[model samples]
Target: MKREDLLFLPISINVTNKKILLIGGGKVATHKGTIMARFVQNVTVVSPEFTDEIRKLPFTFIQKEYEKGDLEGYFLVYAVTGNHDLNAQIKADAEELGILTSVCDAPLLCDFVSPAIHKQEHVTISVGTNARDAYQAVAIRNQITNLFENGTLHI
Candidate 1:
């Protein structure tokens, strides 16, 4: 499969007993980490440096450069490093270990892309543009969130 064949079917993944490894400590990682926290509790972040915002998250933070060994035992990986080369390496390492990886800003290297999501009680809604148009997906998600907030849309 190629990047052009990016047909990411929208589906829900059960992350129970999953250990998520996030390889970044900047703002992007913070955002991703915060989102993951909403759904799961076992997220570990490894980066040489971290943003103040990321440090506030309830996750295990390893203050060191990422290594291939980091992907071991991880169910899912997020290559959110600011360095493109590093993200690519993380993707490669994850693939070698048969772990699903999502590289920030590089959808082609991702096995899956995180979508703009909304959760209300027992209802959850996610919007995405096949990892090709994140801005549009976020816009649509915000609109849906507004509708739900004002009672214009119901589950």
Candidate 2:
């Protein structure tokens, strides 16, 4: 489905204690994994090769290609492999296993879309673009974050 056909709602899921699996080791995985590692306590990233950046996270790293069985016991998964077919397969497997899934750069295959997020203390804000403009989404989130930082927006 195209971006216009998809509508992404920004919501928060309490994943502090849940298991999150990231099935890639490149920049996409590193970027998402870094954000996830901030709030999630249990995360496992799997890939045959890993970038030096992702290796620095406080999470388990498995140096191997993703197998379907590797998805077991995860509450959420991000399919970020460079291969579209592989990412699609991960989404299908996640659907079969009743796990929430997000496929990088492939909105049609994603059950959820990652949004630009800002979290501090007790406040968390997320901004999505309905699968449209990501840069604008971040820009909008930054504007809101500015208000929060300046004490203009408070809970």
Candidate 3:
């Protein structure tokens, strides 16, 4: 099915105590890791190599290649490895285990898409294009942030 054909439901999930797994150590993976760490207390990142940014994060890091059953105990998974084949395998494994998964740059393989988020105190705004147009989503998020900064939109 096409990405546009799917109807994505917008909802918030509480990952306070959930186990989150990130399979990658590159820039893309680091970005996802940083965002997930903000809400999830139990996050483990597995990768053979990592960028400097990810090394600074407080999450547990397993410096090794992802195995077949890496998604076994995680409630959610983010597959951001540069290798498309590995990412596909990760998605397939996560699905088999009924775990929610998001594969970076591949919306069709993702169970859910991550949105461009803007957070201020208790207010949080998210803009997404169903993984169809990331540029447009970021632009919209920036617009919303500007509105809030200019006091055009009150909290």
RMSD list, candidates in order: 1.3, 1.5, 1.2
RMSD of 1: 1.3
Q: Give model 3's TM-score versus the native structure.
A: 0.94
Tens-place lDDT digits, model 3, residues 1-155: 98888666878988767888989999998888887666665889999999999988889999999997778879889999999999999999888899999988888888998998888888888998878898998899999999999999988
Candidate achieving higher lDDT, 1 or 2: 1
lDDT by residue for model 2 over 56-152, one digit each (tens)? 9999989998889999999999999899999999999889999999999998888898889889887778888887888998999899989988999
Off by over 4 Å in 3: none
In candidate 1 the C-alpha lDDT for residue 89 amounts to 92
lDDT scores in order: 0.91, 0.89, 0.88
Which candidate leads the pack in lDDT? 1
Full-model lDDT, candidate 3: 0.88
**Which scores better on lDDT, 2 or 3?**
2
1-41: candidate 1 lDDT, tens digit per residue:
55567989899999998999999998999999989888887
Top candidate, metric TM-score: 1
**If both were scored by TM-score, which would come out higher, candidate 1 or candidate 3?**
1
For each candidate, what TM-score against the reference? 0.95, 0.92, 0.94
